[model samples]
Target: MNAIPGARPPDPKDLVRVRDRLTFLFVERCTVNRESNAISIADGHGIAHVPAAALSVLLLGPGVRITHSAVSVLSESGSTIVWVGENGVRYYAHGSPPSRSSRLLEAQARAVSDPSLRLAVARSMYLMRFSGEDVSKLSLQQLRGREGARIRRLYRQHSQRTGVPWDGREYDPDNFEGGSLVNQALSAANSAVYGVIHAVIVALGCSPGLGFVHNGNYRSFVYDIADLYKADLTIPIAFDIAAGPLTEAVGSAARKKVRDSVREFRLLERCVADIKGLLSIAGPVDIDDEELIVDDLRLWDDREGTVAAGVSYEESAEL
Candidate 1:
């Protein structure tokens, strides 16, 4: 399987085989087999073995045993498995999970506070608005102004630096003839990044709508966090990929391009670092037993112009 960026590099963990189908397993309860080193998923009564090479696996029912050949196919095809159930979704890294920490929250906080980082995010967001890719440009100030002025400014700046055209029109999911494949892939990558950012923000106990920049009546904070990623990482990488070998036809190829670009961008690792850095700058706030560092950032709530006080930076770091 193609390697997932930020996933632990493969190692000699173990190798084992499963003979039965298992289902209804919660993510927290799942474990990898020590002997075959494959993932052994189980509900209370049934069990199944997923080959080690599978990029992603989703358990849809009570009993599902993935055969050795299936695993091989997934590995060779570089496909990710997704589990869909009443509970929630789970993505299994083909190898190992990265070390856990509250660092990403902290970095997010820092990115918002720091001018350079914040500008980076703004630039990235702007680029996304036009080409739907992450390619860095000169600066936010250099871009020309128009309706959705903030967005236009950012995109113009990005275009200036990357030499990619700034198409002010809304994204046309139906039209793929004119746009480059890299542009299409970058857009998909941006969507994925946005999803992850929102998930991380929610995981930290912050509302996604409330944000410092890109304010809206809905989940603004999600946009805020997404904004930070643009400059520091996403924009440059998006542009790099768009300008690279990948083309814009959607489907399996587009999906693969997005995955490959994400890995090549090292977005996951950079995001983790950015979150940690941002939080460290926000400082600490006192909670009951522990200290929570709340950053003075605005988030998007359902109400217009409403800002909720966030958890302390240190507190979010602990999440």
Candidate 2:
């Protein structure tokens, strides 16, 4: 927490809290720059400034270009950057806080690394999705099978309700159009869901690579968290969109609808709480709320750390 002589400290309300911002911002074909401390995006014709720090996730879509300085500033401000293809189908790369706090990471690693604890967490995650079902004795394989069945049933129920043809889940990332309209819509919807989950995972300072049910991919944890909401949010939305008359590109409409549904349902806040509950992580993880004392953070290994000059802050004050 840094307090300048004349420069007033940031009010907790004015702080760039991720939960208050849009779930995620998707930008395409723009050059990112830092004008003073403000982040701006330009696409030749015009320029627009964006509050990058206030954003939870910044999805850099096709033709996006960013400078090293811009990246550094955004990273320092605690925004997660993800580079993806059209409709967020192909994830090219991403950058976020590698490790926010050793405590959370250690806790996550210990739970995920241990066999018994890992399975317990997996069951807990499943229970969160199922809500009321007891998965205490369900093995990982049994849990997976049950999950698949439940999702299939959801697809059927939604299909019947919306009057869309019910087809099994099928998607080919390479040939997206090869599948049915429903499948295409599902793909687009799920991609947007993954983007949000990825941002939250990074912001919480947990390793995305460590997943209980899902494994191998870099975004296993993202998949795990995103799956919890898909049946309720994405799946139904996809069917509704696919059922209605199409006025635009299928993928575009699907993504737009999915985003709208996410916002309406307040899924961003839900995602944060769900992750905290699943990981058994206590307390809040709001980085901006913490007093940013350099010595307290222990940034350097060899050198003695000192507080940033001309910067001190108080936690609470008189009205």
Candidate 3:
């Protein structure tokens, strides 16, 4: 949906349903503007007003230019903004999550800090992935082995089902188009999954750096969460895209297919629910509270007519 000029900012109440309403929006070559507290994106052709609050993730790919006011409106709306290369091949940076409370984030930090609890969470993730296989007592190394085996098996299964030849995971970022068809498709497909899961991870106020199965990078948690759905969702889609007639637009095709399939599966909602379930150390409660702290935004307004200069609205709003 295109945003018209002078549209009212989305109601803060809409934050609760943003995940279910907008899954992912890939934008490029557009200038984002703040109109009547909402976002309006324009190019040389026309102006399209967008509801920044209702999006799960807004992918700012190549050529996208966002204004400061637009950034303020987006953050206030609680949507995750991702800066990435074309077709999301290379993830570079991301905006903070939408929540004001640090309750869930603090819980995540505590669980990941404790050795026993960290291992338990990792094992629980494995059980969920491998269909309840008992890995309660497995060492991290052994768990990695089992995970690798499962991944290999999935590659084989998908290859057989789709008749797409598998020659191991291989791709060069600088030379993506020159790689094998399936390998390129895999990269394209997995990047899309990572983008969506990263949004949910940050939106829930969790740290993307603190991961259970994966570590060391800013996207460790993103990788960990995306891995949960790769075997089932991305793997098959990549294979299917690769199996189609070779074309110059394989990467874009794979991306579009992954996005469509994700929507069909309601994967955005699933990602949010899974993050909550995995991180919930206590009995089930509302892991993500919809209550927003507007005081921070007011501070931003006083400083620069937006959020704090360096700090994101979410960070300023956090208690």
Candidate 4:
């Protein structure tokens, strides 16, 4: 261990689990470098040190200068590094998934490829959203209609609770400022949850493009997963923030509220559980999450589950 510099690389178990990490850290007009195992940020604001391992998403905004060492440490820590545009929230790039195992990812692919199974997965997602509501008898179209109604109701409820005016959801991605105040807050809040969900989705090695409910985009699965929590996580926060006094700080304020709500609801932990449950991965209800991330090396044999990965079976083949 002494041969290693700036403290030893952390054991996998010692590193914080993806579900428990702090939501995000935004850095703009700052320089980022690795100091020991932490990331050092220097800017006109001052200097600060943040534990790289504790970060979920590190948003590098405008006027940011980052060192290679800093990127390396953040990647090693399983923290997502997002490069944004001049406005500070546009997404560009991110870090790789942390999972070494493909168990769940394979399950996802198999489920998504089959039409019936994919519908089944989508139905399961609906159940998660509605909880006690019975959706097994409904087709995807019916479910979609129901979901739309549910969201509209949520918008109304939040609007009344926060006393914020409810206009229909409308916004152009290219023109954030053109939207109304409530719309802007909703967009910002949704983006925050979407970013966190994107990190979780990729960290699990599941295909972001392989969505059961929503499809076509690269982050289809991210959109699908994010929708599950939007009613609880972002919708209310957005309305609450919008109802407050208008200021230039509204976007950041909405994101901050969403971050707090994420922790309060333990959204990350629920998200991981919901995904595993939806995919119908074979396991106990209380299976330890740590066990799922371990790489279970095996050679595929259609009928059999595990074959020795290192063995040569050429001579034993029927051919």
Candidate 5:
């Protein structure tokens, strides 16, 4: 890689707002290179130019070779890059850290740290999955029972609708082939949906590890959020795929369906709105207000509320 005559860093103020940007873009088996600001994807088919600044998330699946220049441009644009397995099952992700604002992350940390707030956030998420019922009075264990029943009903309903066999959900992560056809389909569909939801989480500056309901794993929040849409989006699609004639490429089919469904239902936009609502944010996360984008670094001071980050405080510390 060599420096170009007119190359320059992207202006932060001029970059597209996160909410306005396109959702996750999945690419596999391609060569990624930089052509000025846009990323060039070259594969067996050909090369295509994609504006890195316009994408919120870039999913790099298996068989992809990316360049340093490509990484630099994408990072400057604030796009989140993820490395994943087939059907968007995440393996690793890095790049273009969400440095714009700490509002959502701080709020999430506070909420999770407090037991009461954590319960309330969990209740809010459960309600999102089934708006018809009021589980505000229920405990976490009760909520889990109700959710389990609801998901079971959904599985039965989709199985009937798609004429797929009704069997219990069972799958081993290490051995994908051990599961039945429907189970395999469900796994593939869920993975695809999770990938997209994970992208949204990163774009909004939320920690995938700090979950309100589901916890323990690094992607606890990702699983928590993806649960909201499973009954509506992925489950039915999975059943339908299972109903179709068997294919050796069931995983590929599932991925394709999930991608099309996401685009068709505008799941990214709705996903963004749902997350903001759950987090108690008043409006779209990416607003055009100058004050929101400007750097306002500060230090936490319990007694005085805050102090400037950059200034030396050795005298105050001694006093």
Candidate 6:
């Protein structure tokens, strides 16, 4: 039998350092001294030096280096680097595209349909949203309450568990006027998780716009999958790492810390196992096989439309 998949692997230390290098650029304007092969990012005329050894640079945009060598190294080492650009996020690898398949999509769909699996996803979202607490102890039924009631109860429970002050006021997106430290950190974490979930959904071959929960007009499935991961998996772990003494302002350092933590965390493996268990898949599903599952879902659609499971993929592929 094939061995059970291990935890999500760690990012290379070099990649982490390279990410740190780019982050320095974001917080300050920098000048690259090609003669010295070093980069200096200056803040208010004070310069911070970045060593060339820390990066494998490639020119992508004007005045911007893509860090091609670093990206290649990270991808080769089984890490995913999503570049968010003007056209939206694009996935890249050191060599070839990563494996994604349809059976995994079927498994995820089944997992979402299972009560226990749904609760696990919900609990993960809750814990991630409110760390330093035991939000996982709450039941799925309790979580399904009205938003105001759910938020109020969660605040009180979190406060009681962690002794952290939680004002019951609703979360206001506008409150970050001059950049509240807490708000900024939380927002960054949320965006990071959102990106990860989007990638997962794409890999799974399910239309991210269709979801079993957290319904919206657009990409509801993305929200649903992300919500499942929030409590028990991504958020709490991010908060735990971010709340530590080493945590800093919501800059590249903080973002890297959170991203690295998520990468090292075994959320994906656990998610895969839970999904497989729910779907009763006996073995690991190759991601490249996902188109078949999409075809299956389409067959279901066609049946509902005209009452028939018409031509199979084999027949279609032959044609």
Regarding lDDT, does 3 or 6 come out ahead? 3
TM-score of each: 0.38, 0.80, 0.81, 0.89, 0.87, 0.45
Q: In candidate 2, what are the lDDT values of residues 64-174, reduced to their tens digit?
A: 889977776677667788888976778887895523455555567878888887887788888777777777678778888998899888888898899899758898888
Over the full model, what C-alpha lDDT does candidate 2 score relative to the true structure?
A: 0.75
Tell me the tens digit of each residue's lDDT in model 1 across 144-197. Answer: 232156545656676677776656533344563345644554454454455455
User: Which candidate leads the pack in TM-score?
Assistant: 4
In model 1, what is the error at residue 204, expressed in angstroms? 3.6
Give the range of the ten consecutive residues with the poorest summed lDDT in model 4: 281-290
For model 6, residues 56-160, the per-residue Cα lDDT tens digits are: 221121233334443444333322334432111121221221223355555556656676765554554444445465556666555455334644565455445
- Write down the lDDT of every candidate, Cα atoms only: 0.42, 0.75, 0.77, 0.80, 0.78, 0.42
| lDDT (10s digit) by residue, model 5, range 1-319 | 8788645867677878666676667788999999989999999999999999887778888999999989888887878788887655546765645455667777778788888778778888887777877677887798899999999999888888888888799978778878988888889888877777777777677788998888898889999889888887888888988898866577778877887787787887787777777776322344332233356789999988888899886766655
- Model 6 regions lying over 4 Å from their true place: 1-81, 85-100, 106-143, 146-165, 168-179, 232-248, 251-254, 277-319
Question: Which lDDT tens digits does candidate 3 get at residues 1-319?
Answer: 8888654655556565535757777777887778865688788899987777667788888998898888877877888889999767998898866766555676788889988878877877787876756776777788789989999998999899989888899878898887888888889888888888888777767788999888798889988888888887888888988887866577788778888999988888887777778777533436334642222332336546544445544555545
**Tens digits of per-residue lDDT for model 4, 195-307:** 78888877777788899899898889999999888888788888888888766676778777877888899887888878888887332334355554566788878779678
Candidate 1 C-alpha error for residue 197, in Å: 2.1
Alpha-carbon RMSD, each predicted model? 14.9, 7.8, 8.2, 3.0, 3.7, 11.5
Q: Show the colliding residue pairs in model 2.
A: 1-292, 3-312
Best by lDDT: 4
Per-residue error for 68 in candidate 4, Å, reads 0.7
How do the candidates rank by TM-score, highest first? 4, 5, 3, 2, 6, 1
